[model samples]
Target chain A: MRIACPFCGPRGSEEYTYLGDATVRRPEGDAPSEAWFAYVYLRDNPAGRHRELWYHGAGCRSWLVVERDMRSHDILSVAPARDMALARGRAA
Target chain B: MLAEKYSIVSVVAQALRGQRGWKPVWREPEPRAEYDVVIVGGGGHGLATAWYLASQHGITSVAVLEKGYLGSGNVGRNTTIVRSNYLLPGNIPFYEHSLKLWEGLERDINYNAMVSQRGVLNLFHSDAQRDAYARRGNAMRLHGVDAELLDRDAVRRLYPFFDYDNARFPIQGGLLQPRGGTVRHDAVAWGYARAADRRGVDLIQNCEVTGIRVEGGRAVGVETGRGVIRARKIGLACAGNSSRVAAMAGLRLPIESHVLQAFVSEGIKPLVDGVVTFGAGHFYMSQSDKGGLVFGGDIDGYNSYAQRGNLPVVEDVCEGGMALMPGIGRLRLLRQWGGLMDMSMDGSPIIDRTPVEGLYLNAGWCYGGFKATPASGWCFAHLIARDAPHPVATAFRLDRFATGHLIDEKGAGAQPNLH
Candidate 1:
């Protein structure tokens, strides 16, 4: 699988580190156990198009939100995670 | 027709009769309305659970639902290495119990599961690692499990073909468990399935569970691709898909799915006698009866439901293999495949009751599921039948994480990939 990093062009998956589902939001400091558990462990494992975080450790060292298909290894889109977070009015 | 018992006399008679007096190992049953216990996923753990539930608890009204064919999941995908060398208090007893069960599995199930007790060797490269292994070996001895701390010369005499003089990560010593070895991965599933079937448990294949039905905070039934099948008790033994299936009942588990790849090299003369793990890297290799070198390394440090892995892990594994056994580099790569691992928070498994009544969980087996098959099945059956945790599995509670009672076996903390 190749990820088109925002900083580095299409690079092999070896150059990046995969952090699971980009959709999970960390719970508040005093949230209940359920909230924390969900944030830490729950995953949808969607078969179709999904968003995930990949760290380009070898090249530009930038965090990217890669939209790829789970069923088929097809990269749909890629953008900086910070930009995606700010666009959604959330903290990076 | 009933399956015939396999024996030398029966085999000779079948040979004399043109070898046609055989029956299907297990019946392919159609879905029934309800059962006393319904186990989701027809892998090794699920089949073993059903077998124990009937043989021990006399709960014969059980159904094992499989999304695919039996033994097509991780049960058949692992590297087939079995061992009981563990350090933690929660894991040593459980795995030791599993090793004992593996020792008697073939006779107990009346099947030739190809259980070879050759032993397992974990090499140490540095002085610090030797000390750590010494501690673990002592812990195993304390638990009455066999463990031997081999010195550098002891290891050299046993396997002199290793890269002993490697400038980096030179050979120091190892921890040996004579009872640790390998088993026929697919045969285990078939043996358990046949035993469970003989005890009147329905073995349903190609039946995918779509949703879990909960009524008044209790699991009552499941909606599958076939139809609605009700059950008094349900067990979620779907290793990689634990999170997805548990979500059907509005429950979230502390599991993340990651792909782990295993590889085999071209058949050659028997090389390694037992399982050997590289101390410097995440590579381990053992020879199969067919002469193929069966081995695997770390899980692809990512969350993936896919059964295929990227090239990076492939390269990394090959490098580790060559570093340990350079002669294998000349062998041709025959085939490689991946299995989704149900990685847990602290690297330990969970075999406890879920929050929803009548629903039990048996998952979070990062790298130890195959070795834990028999014990996992026995303890899970106990939990389902008695509605209480077994004595050995008391620490694998679902609420442990909430109470900060995590069993960090590898000290990997909360990262699933690290485990």
Candidate 2:
């Protein structure tokens, strides 16, 4: 599978490290144990159209959120995860 | 009714009678309206759970609902290796129990699973790797599991064809377990299914579980393709589909499904007598009874529900194979298959009750699900019947991750793909 990285254009999957389920939200430090547990452990491993986190180790070293179809393995969209986080007002 | 005994006498008698007296090994039963216990996923683990439930606990009114046919899951797709040479305290006893179960599984089920106790050799390269093997072997011995440390010459005497002189990764020594070997993967499913069916457990095929019906925080039944079949307790052994199936009960699991592929070469003369694994790379190989080299490497480092893999993994696996054994490069690759592995955060399994009442889980097997089938079923049956974790599987609880008791066997931390 080839991922069209925002910074590196297109690259093979071997160049990137997979971090599953980009939708997970880390809870605040003062949050309850259940919230932290859900954040740390729980995942929605859907069959199609999954947004996942990937780290480009061999290229631009940028963290990306690649929207790919899990069933067909087709990459639909790729953007910098940091940029997406900032757009979502998640960055500190 | 007396179960058919497969023996040479029966074979000869059937041959004399034009081979017409043979009966079907298992009955294809229609799903009943309700069952005492329902096991979703009719793979090896599910069927074996039903068998153990009947034989050990006398729970005869059980039903195993399969989304597809039996043996269609990882049970039929694995590289058919059985070993208990583990290094961790949390995993050693559990797999040792499974290995012991595999030793007597044929006699217990009265089926020829062809459980070959040849051996398993983990080849080590550098001095550091040799020490690691030594430590692992010693740990296995501490757990009362048989393990032998082999020198470099010892491995060469057993298999002289390895690329030992390669400068990148020179072969030094190995860890050998004589009792650890291979079993016929599909026959295990068939054997367990027939045994469970003989005990009046319903083997319902093509019965996809669409939802888990939880009533008042307790699992009451399942909404399947056939219909809503009620059960007193439900066990989820759906493997890669564990997350999706558990979600129906409003429960989220710490699992990500990844595809792990296996390959088999065209029929040739016997090359590998037992299971052999390379130390430097992710390559393990064995010769099938059909004279084909059956092998597999690492799992595709991506979360996927698809039962297929991309080309990169294939190329990487072939490279590992060539790096270890150059002679295999000339052989034609005959078939390749992928099985979805339920990779846990700590790379261990969870066979325990969920927070929801009457709901049991047996999943997060990673790539070691096939070898753990017997003990997993036995322990899962114990948990379901008694409402507690089995003695050996005490550490494999769903709450372990929450309690910071992760059994990181490979020391790979929380990364499921790394484990």
Best by TM-score: 2
DockQ of all candidates, in order?
0.52, 0.76
Query: How many Å off is the CA of B330 in candidate 1?
Result: 0.9
Docking quality level of the chain pair in candidate 1: medium
Q: What TM-score should be assigned to candidate 2?
A: 0.97
Native contacts retained, all candidates in order = 0.42, 0.77
For residue B94, model 2's alpha carbon misses the true position, in angstroms, by: 0.9
Residue clash pairs of candidate 1? none
Summarize candidate 1's per-residue lDDT along B1-419 as a digit string, tens digits. 45777788888999999988777888888889999999999999999999999999999999999999988999999999899999999989999999999999988998999999999999999999999999999999999999999998999898999988788988898999999999999999999999999898999998999999999999999999989999999999999889889989997777778889999999999879999999999999999999999999999887777888889999999999888888888999999999989998888999999989999999999978999999999999999999998899999988887778999978877788888
Kindly report which residue stretches of model 2 are placed more than 4 angstroms away from their true locations once superposed.
A90-92, B1-3
Candidate number of the best lDDT: 2
Candidate 1: where are CA atoms >4 Å away? A30-34, A45-48, A90-92
Q: Pick the candidate with the highest DockQ.
A: 2
lDDT of 2 by residue, B52-99 (tens): 999999999999999999989999999999999888888999999999
Among residues 3 or more apart in sequence or in different chains, the pairs in candidate 2 whose N, CA or C atoms overlap within 3 Å are none
lDDT over C-alpha atoms for residue B1 of model 1: 48
Lowest summed lDDT window (length 10), candidate 2 chain B: B1-10
